[model samples]
Target: MTEDMKMDTVVALLRDQPDPINVLYAVSLMGLTKGLWKVSGAGSAGVTRAFGEDIWRLIKIGSTLLKADQDTSNPQKAMEFYDSYLIGRFNVADSMDYDVTDDSIEITVKNCRAHHYTDYLEENDVPRSVGCPLALGCAAMMEEVTGDPFIVDSIESKDGNSKIVLKKF
Candidate 1:
């Protein structure tokens, strides 16, 4: 497709709200900015993961990490890993719509850094500690900034370099 055509499509998709928040992508760490947006962190393509984050304050902490990648491991970068990389940074998104299903509350997050994820199985304790220091640090900063209780939904890896597509709630 032509550049204009592609942009037009993107604009249209962004404007079209799937749920309270909807996201879709074919790779390149695209975030659901309205519809789908490409994140610069990706080397080639991008992907996204859904969320059931119960703590709103922690959500802000994760966003702070994305804003600062290399500098996230500072002492202020939370005292944990999962909280930094997964909860604080990867789950960075505003204007969320909560989907209360029979099992979980679905919140859509697009263009999340899958590789940086580490909160898959962490203890419910403070002072984030996943593995990556930078990621953890970033999560710490996230808590300092956003004061929300953030949790991870899923950690998706590219596996072998394929396009990423996200589902809306």
Candidate 2:
């Protein structure tokens, strides 16, 4: 297929699914691609893992691009980024709640897809700390965009829900 046809296929798939499903679909595709590359000896396992993680970092940065377009220091911008950008892209926007303080933002993902995805991995003996990179990438992107230190204050994914607290470093 031509590049345009491939893009059209991707667009169609995304449009047909809900955002959370899209996120999961994207994860599935990434896994399949990585697994195939490993089987084909396209790259070493470490290299492939790094490549996949770098791509995810870029995606996380891209998701926070809207925040860069706005005044990052604004509390409302922070809230919008949390609600619309971070949670929104995960297809959990409706299920997340956040509070914006003067120097911190706390968010609770009542039903995080990543948490469930991690559970699925653990059940199958896939040793991966799935949520940290995504969270840290977002924090890194936010810090870069806002010129303010941002750190993951706490992340609890073992429980039924994923709760993340981002605070100024």
- Per-candidate TM-scores read 0.19, 0.47
Candidate 1 lDDT by residue in tens digits, 1-118? 3556435434544444343334243111222221222222221111211222223235445445556443434323332333344544445322222333222223333333332222
lDDT of 2 by residue, 3-43 (tens): 56435534544554467765676668446543544465433
Cα lDDT computed for each candidate against the true fold: 0.30, 0.52
Candidate 1 is scored at a TM of 0.19
RMSD of 1: 15.7
